[model samples]
Target: MTYSLPRQLSSLLLATSILLWSCESFAPRPPPQRKVIVTGAAGRTGKLVFSSLLKQANFYPMGLVKSEKSAKKIIKDNAECGLENVWICDVTKLDSDNEGSLPNGIRGSDAMIICTSAVPKLRKRHLAKALLKAPINMLAGKKPLDFKTLQFYFAPGQHPEKVDYEGQIAQIDLAKKLGVSHVVLVSSMGGTNPDDFLNTLGKDKDGNGDGDILVWKRKAERYLVESGLQYTIIHPGHLKDTPGGLSELWLDVDDNIMMSPSHHMMSRCDVARLCVASLKVSGGQSSSFDCINIDVPEGTKSRPTEIALIEFLDAETTYDYSTDRKLDYSMNI
Candidate 1:
């Protein structure tokens, strides 16, 4: 015999089922997590980047450091932030022959952000002495200094050519090998023009006509551009340690622009935000630009605008600024 409920009771049961199904359908689901590797995770900018990544719900950050000390420090600094993963690997020590031997921690990453830069410490006198002892390959050129052996003879700790240029190249090579989806480079302004004010900060220790630091950075940028990997290169103006997200941001793609007069500056926190934004907005696309903090009206606190990377990239030829006028914002690739 078929069992049947009362007509009114059956209608009430159906309404309850429909209400439960509707609630389930409207419930929010968690975002998918993506692994990101941050090089130079112990440095100022790197720390900021790591911290910001930690706050995001979908990004899982793994910091790549050069020593146990740095790893320990990062863990301690972010203990309250619940940061867990920290890998020790020196980018400068990587070589093509041993490319396959990269640390397991850096593997399986979906993206990478290179924030390493050499801290200038070598004096002019010491660099001159090292140059004297450097091996010369007359077949190469007038400046026959061998780049392979120059780092060993020069400042032992960190040099721009070794750290900024060679180290970045090694990271790029590793990213390619690992099949990372995108590589975001945290570069500085004034990389294209050697005569910019930042290039004038330190003396030319290598006796080369080009500015030592900026020239190497530009070389690394070019290598990344040619590597065919999806990349976003952000050239932040003079970095400040102020609070972030309070001021509007201006972006341009003209490389000749300079961050002068001390007022043109960006907070490291904002730079970190942009680095993370690049991964979210510019995935599978490549572009390079400069960023600075735009002044806000007094007593009016404004937040930075959220811009899609494609829109910014598409505006390449849409700039209507006068060529003769010198604006505070510009960027270039």
Candidate 2:
């Protein structure tokens, strides 16, 4: 129907106002600010993590070293590189009298990465004896047990039991207390399978024991999941140093496939790159993942830009960083 000029003018004004409002409503948001902390900063992966952070334009890195000496070394290195603010921490507590407890630190981190493990060579019977007697060595004022001495007691068929998982958990608990939001764990690839060689100490489908190694890892991984923080668990395969980068990334938590393609062969520098990439991802929180290195994509020679991990933390929930879910995912060939 035909309308008067004044009526048409009113209609036009209404449409124009609607358009302006819609434009305002659909405006894009700015990127959020992020702070990151990396544990084991003095170790190989930690060093790589530190280097990668230095190259990143946005990341504010907090490096966690184990001892005063390590802290000094990191500080000196950073100062030489014009980097600053590395924190020294103890992620695990061990009896110095007990052999095989290596020193690395964890402190003031937003996310923690446990790249620590031990290879036990002692027979179970012998190890039990040592565990019982090591306390006496200290009481008798004998020289403290060193790794070399501990290795002397290893039996050919027996593997060394790990001692640091509990300590790492304590560090995670501390991080939660300090309000850190994310944790990225560097776990081994075969960890999910009960029968894999890596599943040393844990139970299998038959309820038998391979050893204690896998048991400890599973326990540790489980704790991280229940800790109520955003986490990305990285399960890496057999590692080797390769000349080029990785081509495939396999992620699984089921189907009993223990070993897959390894990104371990890549340089420590590349591992660090991946860890840093995980930290920057918006949706990567509260999830477990696997990382392995492969040849760069065909016809794509340059190293691709790292993808930031996505957070899995539910948007509806407020994070206290102390609560998490036990969830699992698997992708297999």
Candidate 1 residue-wise lDDT, 11-101, digit = tens:
9999999999999999898877789989998898999999788878899898988898998888888853433578888888765457566
The per-model lDDT (C-alpha) reads: 0.74, 0.54
Per-residue lDDT tens digits for candidate 2, residues 81-162, read: 3334565445555333333442222224455555555344444564566677877889899754543333222233233233
Per-residue lDDT for 48 in model 1?
93
Q: Which residue pairs in model 1 clash with each other? A: 252-331, 253-331, 253-332, 254-331, 254-332
- The per-residue C-alpha lDDT of model 1 at residue 126 equals 52
List residue ranges in candidate 1 displaced over 4 A: 1-29, 80-84, 96-100, 122-157, 200-211, 259-262, 298-305, 308-311, 317-333
Query: Could you tell me which 10 consecutive residues in candidate 1 have the lowest summed lDDT?
Result: 324-333
Go through the candidates in order and give the clash count of each.
Answer: 5, 40
RMSD of each: 10.8, 15.3
Model 1 lDDT on a 0 to 1 scale: 0.74
